[model samples]
Target chain A: MAVSDEQARDELGERLRKFVGRPAAVAGAGKDPVNAPMIRHWCEALGDTHPAYTGPDAIAPPTMLQVWTMGGLSGHPGRTGAYEELLGLLDAAGCTAVVATDCEQEYPRPLRPGDEVTFDTVIEEVSGRKTTRLGTGYFITTRTEVRVAGEPAGVHRFRVLKYAPAPHRPHEPRQQRRGPELHEPRRHQEPESRRRQEPAPSKPLRPRPVINRDNAGFWQGVAERRLLIQRCTACGTLRHPWLPGCNACGGLGWDTVEASGEGTVYSYVVVHHPPAPGFDPPYAVALVELAEGVRMVGNVVGVPYDEVRIGLPVRAGFRRVDEELTLPVFQALSSVTAVER
Target chain B: MRAGERLEPLEIPVTRTLIVAGAIASRDYQDVHHDPELARRKGAPDVFMNILTTNGLVGRYVTDHFGPKAVLRKVAIRLGAPNYPGDTMVLTGTVEEVDGDTAVVRVVGANGLGDHVTGTVTVTVPGANPEATP
Candidate 1:
């Protein structure tokens, strides 16, 4: 068998960028006109109760621009042959696995109920062959323009990495001796100190919070060692994280309410791989439903990641990891000792 | 505005809570954004940031600059590198063109690794830039 030529691979990488700027989807209309059911499902799934998405003056969330353009289970109408060919080319080059990496949206006007939506997507840019943790691949970016009744309403930029899956590394005998997942969750106990023992991280720190006008107040409450959720002044609805307007009533008036710090883990994931800087791998992160009836995501401490289960009782606590950063975390309370609340 | 006007950079600190909260807010259930062990198996060095969080941040960056009234017509951004927790990302923008209330601006968000997000945004600010007035 002959080894593949490296130069030929480089040429394939160059060929991808040429497809940029070509229209990938042309004049595709959404199957369903924008309506209440879809909007309700979306907000419910995200746990967003902002009042703007309901009632007579309802507007869809701006972050949902791509949702309106989704082809759904049936698939999209405007997908062109060229887009297929582009994927085929990459597949032939051994880049078959794909994962959505990021997306961007710009809204000129909010989408309203009963609006008929149409959109077109262009193959905006294709990157050079780049190596990522998953494998070597190119980044394909598509720009979509969404229109409501022939008027431009929003634009969405979506990108994905289509890569050849990374080869699995043979495990050390010690690692092989243990069960795949059971041994991992314990390592999160001493994250920062353990990080000091590992080799230097090749990547930068993880992305941070984007504090702005709508959400800055929430962070300030965290700094002051309090858990705050937004409460609608008009309808008495309590919301978590925070939003500019109430989705329940479309009320602009809101005030902050302190939480009781006790909650239950609604769902959780015991992360096992991808050890990171300053954090021990195999940690558990949970979506906790606060006593206030709003959910927030945070790390679950005081137990092995594997011990964190759905419905586990937890209490909020502040962990000042460093002088610059303090996070709101939850400590898993032992279920064996306490009676059900 | 001509091509050279720059928007002030916003400095943001990445925290574990930020990464997890942003992921949930966007309805992304991917473990890589919240769980370290799963992320390791997927080949990430640590639980890394997700693209949705970056998209939301970029949207906030533009709106924060244009004030509350400005409307974004288009935001086309590309992700370059992974943003891990414990790092800072600085977002900055420059106006590229202005025509009749619509202005095109180039935005770049740089973290410790390199550029995290780079894109162009088209926005309409009713009465801000002199050149945008017809």
Candidate 2:
């Protein structure tokens, strides 16, 4: 009497469930104590200049709750065999690929510099098999408790999907296949027309900027082909994106200063997936640090997305994206203008 | 911190270097975040930004708008669209509720694909006055 496919699945799930409630890691210690260098590295990578993350009284960015617990490329010493055995079972069951899908963090108390961090992890749950754009897979969730000196500091809940790759359709070229999915529940159905590669229905207009009372003047400036930066009347500090008050002095009074339009690419990213309406994919968006010492985000024109790099000199240019929308974009300058800052 | 008050929108360009750098910074060595070739083999067109990076971006958006003094108490985010290189994620937030110095902000980070992250962040701003006019 041969076992049916359903029976095999049930057995596999049963074995997987046994791992739940079991300890995945016991008393894992952070490779380093909470410190400033790691925080600085994190802030630089994300382009975050928030002051609270630095100085003598600095605390790690609350979002970095998970970074301290990571074992890096070497792997964690406290990881028990149970977690690996669980993964081995999944691989044996043909679920070889994995992708992290979700994360939820709560900071009960800030992890300050010099706080020794330790954590414990448990396999919280394992979902039943389900089919997704990537293929069939199981969702595995783990909950971790982080502590400093045996005092609760934070909690992190993480989830991932382990699945077998969906077999490719023989007729379609690999490049034409859909991009990686972020696991949105409602976008399950791919329109037949899209799958057939019909001329993408007429492009949609660019998304309009969300203008409020505080930032309306900035948009007005753009319409007139001038890039404006907000200056605090009290502290003389310059800011961007038009806030209600000055971050430096908390002053409510402010005025506008026209930008010199000259700037350098402080940082940048290339957008590749979930194609934007009205724009082609793989365009470069740069964080241009203006000559006046304020930073603003805009498209880096006159260069391919791949060629856009840090320290690239740029000059602000206003482009009327649509009848109602005029945006400030940066024109990449020639190497002759790329002076080292 | 009045209810229904909206924060200025923040536009973040999703770049290749950011994706790889963020992954490395957070110790997330997932191939989908750095190795494009391996990512493609695993069924991704190209490497995508990891969730940790998205979380950090969201945190930055909130604190940037609330001023540098604001401290985050909790950030519970759910991922939607994948933030692929060459895209932008516009982060917008609304003050849903406020009590003294603490406020709960409903944040949504939308990219070209759609909402990349949606969650509520609890933050406390020292000496925040709810009666102050905008």
Scored on chain A only, each candidate's TM-score is 0.49, 0.51
How do the residues A1-341 of candidate 1 rate in per-residue lDDT, one tens digit apiece? 01122123567778888898898889988777777877776655433455556788777756667766665434557777777668756654446445665566778788888888899989988988775544567888888899998899887777787765543332223233232211112221112222344554343334456889999888777766578999999998999768988989999999999888889999988777787765656789999999889999998865567889999998776554432455677866552111100
- Winning candidate number (TM-score): 2
Per-residue lDDT of A202-251 in model 2, one digit per residue for the tens?
54778888989999999878766578999999999999978999999899
- Give, for candidate 1 chain B, the lowest lDDT window spanning 10 residues: B22-31
Best by lDDT: 2
| Chain B fold agreement for model 2, TM-score | 0.94
The candidate scoring highest on DockQ is 2
Clash numbers, per candidate: 23, 10
Q: Estimate, for each residue in B1-134, the C-alpha lDDT of model 1 and write its tens digit.
A: 46688999988687777777766545455666788876654456676666666765676677678775566676676665567788788899999988877789988887776677787878777767665435
Q: How is the predicted docking of candidate 1 categorized under the CAPRI scheme?
A: incorrect
